[model samples]
Target: MNKSVALTGNEAVATAMKQIEPDVVAAYPITPQTDIVQYFSTFVADGQVKTEFVTVESEHSAMSATIGASAAGARAMTATSSQGLALMWEVVYIASSFRLPIVMPVVNRALSGPINIHCDHSDSMGARDSGWIQLYSEDAQEAYDNVIQAIRIAEHPDVLLPVMVMQDGFVISHAMQNLEILDDESVKKFVGTYKPDHHLLDVKHPMTVGSLFLPNFYFEAKKQEAEALERAKKVIQEVAKEYAAISGRQYGFFETYRLEDAEVAVIALNSTAGTVRGLVDEYRAKGLRVGALKPRVFRPLPHEELVVALQHLKAIAVMDRAESFSTHGGPLFNDLRSVLYESKERPVVTNYIYGLGGRDLTLDELRRVFDETLEAARAGYYRNRVTHLGVRE
Candidate 1:
């Protein structure tokens, strides 16, 4: 029922967007993420899809246009990377606050200062608290799949929130990989239709979308938004289960690789998980009890699930591609550490910030990371809680 094809991550996401064929597609061009919209634009130009493609001048306008479209009860989508995401900061929160079910595919790239167009989690990590559901992908296959699933997740009645599906720039975005793609009709049926209960275009109901909430009312509204995000966790799982039935691939908040019964393990997201998995196999073959954890859903945090999975381990090394500049550690490290704090028996957790600006994470460096974690497990203490890997001495 599916066809096997080789596609770059950008192409794969583009293909997914084509299949979903949202009512509106509004986006501006940015490296790594540009090709996704570019490919979809071709679908529009060729009459393959009847999506109203908006050619925006800036990322901010792109998001504003998407929010407008979604508010009008149209299923809207967009894509961005690096500074483009940063530019959409103001409207990004607006999209979520208004509870528009907009789906966006973000190609992860380092934020600029010295100006580098390369892979890193900084772009999306910076927006963690902006009230959007976030999903990270390890490869082209997951990127494609996540985009399709995001439509259902965002539009769920209980969880009408924007969703950001992220894939590593250059690493996953540009690299080619073989992936299974569902036929267009199947995807359409799986996503169904987008019929919002309330919209600006609903003249009979007539309501204000971005109405300002005074201090007395704002707190409760914000609380409701938080609850909606919490509800999204269950909706995400339910969607994944349904998607699995159709695609034969199962997904969860996070993936555990030989983690049950392992004493020490590495935790990461995006394409780095591939490296961790390969090294995990090598370590296991060498009679070591090392494993890996790849987090797929990040926004809802999945604290309880992660705590249950990690509480048994003696030590854990969290790999973060983006620096939090918190001095304590990166974003992922701090979040995981906070989650483990609630555990009855917490592991000795350390942080490794690596692969910034597209620096490759070699297996040798990963092996050393594992060895350090194993040593910490045996000694019951870590030499350093935070480290920057592959940096010049």
Candidate 2:
């Protein structure tokens, strides 16, 4: 039995956690992400779930504790945003390197310097190389669904890697939207149990974890981690399929909106994709062949799926909310360009850096980007390959 309810992204995530009822949750509060831990902690106090909630002193300690719990054969989860994620940098890599299967919901925010606390991809994007499987949600529904599925994906034996379920801070995180809530028993059955093959608590077979690795073995360890991430692509699909069977909502590595016959298209992530989809609908109704692609799974890249989805377009525009500071393009744009580089039928892709530090990305600004992409598709060249949309000139 599914129930419909209005929920902020943070509340939706907390609700999902209540249903899944993981063995442990070790978290430190940060702006935007703080509500998630706060709400879940209430459930802990009321004894709604049996999860052991650990309030850590810092983000670093939170992740370290979560890693410890996971290694001890318990399902562990946490939540954070911006500087909090930055503080967890060291253990972020360690969690994945050790294949701990820790699930974290990162409410995306800009990294500090200007000391602004708002939404952006910089935090999670910075940790892209940390080997966590990244999943972006477009709305509260996806945010709730992704966190539930992430548990299964991360714990799969073939892919024992941590997962980052991301939602744009305040944009999706604070905004309220109505979404379907799955019954607790259904979610529990779908997620099943977290049974690792090897664990510290398995007294019958004592094992070692996090041992120091020197040059001779360090390279091999990284290679194994890479392989596990690659294998997660298949596991992600499997979990999504099973989840869809129960939840009746289908998901993919990326979603294509009116792309079948589109000549111009935009690629985006998170809540902005909803805005892009609205623009795509308008253009579609106007008889323009413009479309949009929203990537759900960012890490592991989804090269083949992206290639198939984008191979037909004449021009592609990728919008990144966070600046890579590469002076070339944002992270999503760079990844798309690299993936399409080898395609026999490739689109002339362009990059749009927008909405940094919670700056507004107006509908008019988005419309102009689509107009430029259409113009470039017809002209066979971009006026400029890289652009900063919605920024002061």
lDDT of 1 at 53: 99
Tens digits of per-residue lDDT for model 1, 60-111:
9999999999999999999999999999999999999999999999999999
How high is each candidate's TM-score?
0.99, 0.99
- The residue-by-residue lDDT of candidate 2 on 1-393, one tens digit each, is 999999999999999999999999999999989999999999999999999999899999999999999999999999999999999999999999999999999999999979888998999999999999999999999999999999999999999999999999999899999999999999999889888999999999998898999998999999999999899999999999999998899999998888998999999999999999999999989999999999999997899988888988899999999888889999999999999987887789999999999998999999999999999999988998999988786
Query: For model 2, which pairs clash?
Result: none
Relative to the true structure, candidate 1 reaches a TM of 0.99
Q: What's the lDDT for residue 296 in model 2?
A: 99
* Residue 229, model 2: Cα distance from true site in angstroms: 1.0
